[model samples]
Target: MAQPALGPAEAEGPCSTPLESPVHPVDEKPAPSRLVPAALQHIAAMYAGVVTPPLIIGQAVGLDQAGLTRLIAASLLIAGCATLLQTLGIGGFAGNRLPFVNAASSAGIAPMLAIAETSAPGHQLPVIYGAVLVAGAFCLAIGPFFGRLLRFFPPLVTGVVITLIGVTLMPVPVSWAQGGDKEAADFGAMKYLALAAFTLTVILIVQRFGRGFVRQVALLIGLLAGTLAAVPFGLADFSAIRSAPESLDDQDDGEGEGGQGE
Candidate 1:
């Protein structure tokens, strides 16, 4: 094959050599009308994400309803604080200064559950929290060098890991279907199972029949419908909500407890 000669313009162009910065130029400001709608969507996305990890881990660890509530409240507080810092860090001393939702993640659930099972009954939560703290510190320590490590994790490896995460998590929804109060004698009773089925049906119905915002929030709608449906079956528990802490300080006073979700 003949070697192609570079033209005069090609030789002089900026593309002749590699560019360094990867950041693309973007509009600094968005339409004012979009702000509220964008914020609402963010809240919607964060709703399920912020709740699931704490709910699952707390329940799996045998926390009572009060304890579970506290764990979830704490997770929400931490996620909110982290998100704010991530979006508005001063002088790049912390955070990425982006509108990123920093919330509890589901990735570490398996490991945390393993830790809970291995630890003595009463000591489960403390040991698991210690492991989490150490892991977070390790991640911070390696943050600057993490880019180079990505070379070892190509698309195929990442895809497999994601699929495994999904597979490993399948039991969680099943557990939810049974009943939140696993210790109750009537747990997984026909009524509870029927409620779960109805909730799923509602989700599917909305996805298939609704449009726009209704479809977008099908899961949430189904959840609300389920809660309402459960009232007649004596599955609803309103005392938890009534007794819930009024403020962060209240939740703090009750905290002896803690999920990874999104």
Candidate 2:
């Protein structure tokens, strides 16, 4: 009643045939058409965060309008390169290759402004840059060894770190919504709160009800909506950019003086 055993070729044939991988939604690569929009959305989300740091620190260090513009352009370029390195990586050792967006941290603003405050008037920016260079070198040198400490932080401890970061940053939004500077007379004005609420409501509505690309670009749309809304209230002002110099040489004369230095 027992069947005869298969030959070696028959047995090996079944084993040698390639097994197909199961298609998983989670592992699926998005089409290039859809991929671009997804990336832009992430850029939209992080744009303000990346731009604000350079603006704040550059102004605090007493950069002129021309110098501030150069700082902002440099910041954006560096952030883009950092993000690419983080997501794509060089070989296997350099980058995390995660879905993370790397940019300048707002957390450093206080320390940097403190540095600027202690420095002499015309010398502040040079000192701040030197400090930043030294700090960056120290961080890079310690990174490999410091990564080993990750094992010491359980989920609870990690959660505490996140909570502390959020708690510390919570005041920044409150200050922004109250008209930026805490010492200003209009620091707790109702107009700013109303503007912020209106912007939030518009963003939420677009995100919740919009379909396809509308939903994807809600942040950008909300910003446009908010700017238009601000016009009636006289809150938005862009006079500085309106008065920008005609030529690039004049705009960034500091760099134009020398052809290209080492």
Which candidate wins on TM-score? 1
- Per-model lDDT: 0.82, 0.80
* Tens-digit lDDT string for candidate 2 (104-170): 7876777777888899998887888898899989988898899799889899997887677667556
- Which stretches in model 2 have alpha-carbon errors above 4 Å? 1-19, 22-29, 155-190, 196-223, 252-262
RMSD of 1: 8.0
After superposition, which runs of candidate 1 have C-alpha atoms over 4 Å from their true positions?
1-27, 181-184, 204-216, 243-262
- lDDT of the structure predicted as candidate 2: 0.80
Taking all chains together, each candidate's TM-score versus the true structure is: 0.74, 0.70
Scored by Cα lDDT, where does model 1 land?
0.82
For candidate 2, give the lDDT of residue 93: 66
Q: Over all chains combined, what TM-score does candidate 2 have?
A: 0.70
